[model samples]
Target: MTLSFQRIAYEALNVCNGVTMAALEAAVERTGLAPGAAAIDIGTGNAAVAVRLAERFGLRVTAIEFDPVMADLARQRIDAAGAGAEVTLAVAGAADVLARSAPVDLIVALGTTNVTGEGRPTPEAGFTALRRKLRPGGWLLWGDIVWLAEPPAPLRQITEATNLYTDDAGWRAAATGAGFEVITGRISDPAEFEAYPRDAVTAVRAWLEAHPDAPEAASIRFHADRVQAITDFGRDYIGFGVYLLRNPD
Candidate 1:
């Protein structure tokens, strides 16, 4: 996707996954992070979650976004929220930030493609890397795609092209292997699952309709159609899951 359109698409979303903001708030509240605690929100597109962390949980947040364009937008969000260092923006890759970041009270990884580093991303790789970055008994709020069943080859190829994910059991096993106790997890409801991609595509369509003559309009539409097609087919075998995990004390 073109960088210009990518920004618009991201701006269209507050939460990348299918779950509602209320659901996320409930999960964060349950994590019991106290006021003035620290947090790092990786891949914080548009900084919605970061803002929420500060506004809702009263946590000091470092909002990380590797893309300069998205980071600019995120900066705008923080300013608009009239927040100070309560939510800081870190415009660096996840691995780079993790290398020097101090352990914090919480980590938010909602739809984050890479948590720990840049090597071929897997559930286990991400879980282990995160373990080293958390204080004992600290929390990790993870959200990502889950394969409900063995997906067909074509669908699998498309979904795994970016970051490798796994089934519900696999996610739990990986976290447990990395010494995290999986406190709880929730799978998206069927309607919720369908809405994620649908909304994304709708955002793109709305952009195209409004900017019919923009140079990148065709490219944007092409990518949007591809996304719509992929999700339409994989809906039966795929879902989004939010898991609350804790590093062992």
Candidate 2:
């Protein structure tokens, strides 16, 4: 099977999501999650956060990633991290995976809520669906893009074409509407927002240089360039954050 452009572009990176490792660790720490807590990481690309949860906090994690390539990569990483025993890796959509697993103390869905297949056209709907799989008082480490300021029409149109994200206040309100209490959230800094796609582009460019004749090189470059463009033009208005939310008891 042909590898997806996304996989080609991001597989080499430790974490596919835009947030930095330090940022992720800080957000997780704020949750005050105890060792041995049960957690589920939905859309766990490369198992970065999943492995951290298992290795650092000793949490038992059910990590779900829909993309086959990503799932395989995650599995490899988990094994290499010696976290295979603590993490159960599933190659399935977040909704499907959650349906089959038991309720957990935490649910983490970062940058892939659409995997829930909720027809409702917003991340809030996805959050609502995932909330059902969380035990009462459980935490959710939700991460995605949001608008820092209302953008120009062109930028707004571009962003709305693919993402249903809103501003920070909107996200907090949506969480409340989805029966979650917003604990705290941290938005990505300008440096992080700039670095993520920059790094991906650099990696893809290096790969292309090494494999000039590869059939997939063009497609990978296209994706990398697209990401870079978005990062370049949208960084002013677009932002990413990890919001810690609690399912109210």
Query: Top TM-score: which candidate number?
Result: 1
On residues 35-131, what C-alpha lDDT tens digit does candidate 2 reach at each position?
9999998888888889988888789999988889878778888888889889999888777777777788998778875645664357677778878
lDDT of each structure?
A: 0.85, 0.81
lDDT of each residue in 1-249, candidate 1, tens digit only: 345655777778877677777878888898887899989999888888889889987899998898898888889989999876699899999889989999988998877766656756779889889878899889999999889999999999987887888999999999998889999899989898777778778888998999999888888888898888888898789999899999888
Report the C-alpha displacement of residue 29, candidate 1, in angstroms: 1.3
Give the C-alpha lDDT of model 2. 0.81
What is the RMSD, in Å, between candidate 2 and the native fold over all Cα? 1.8
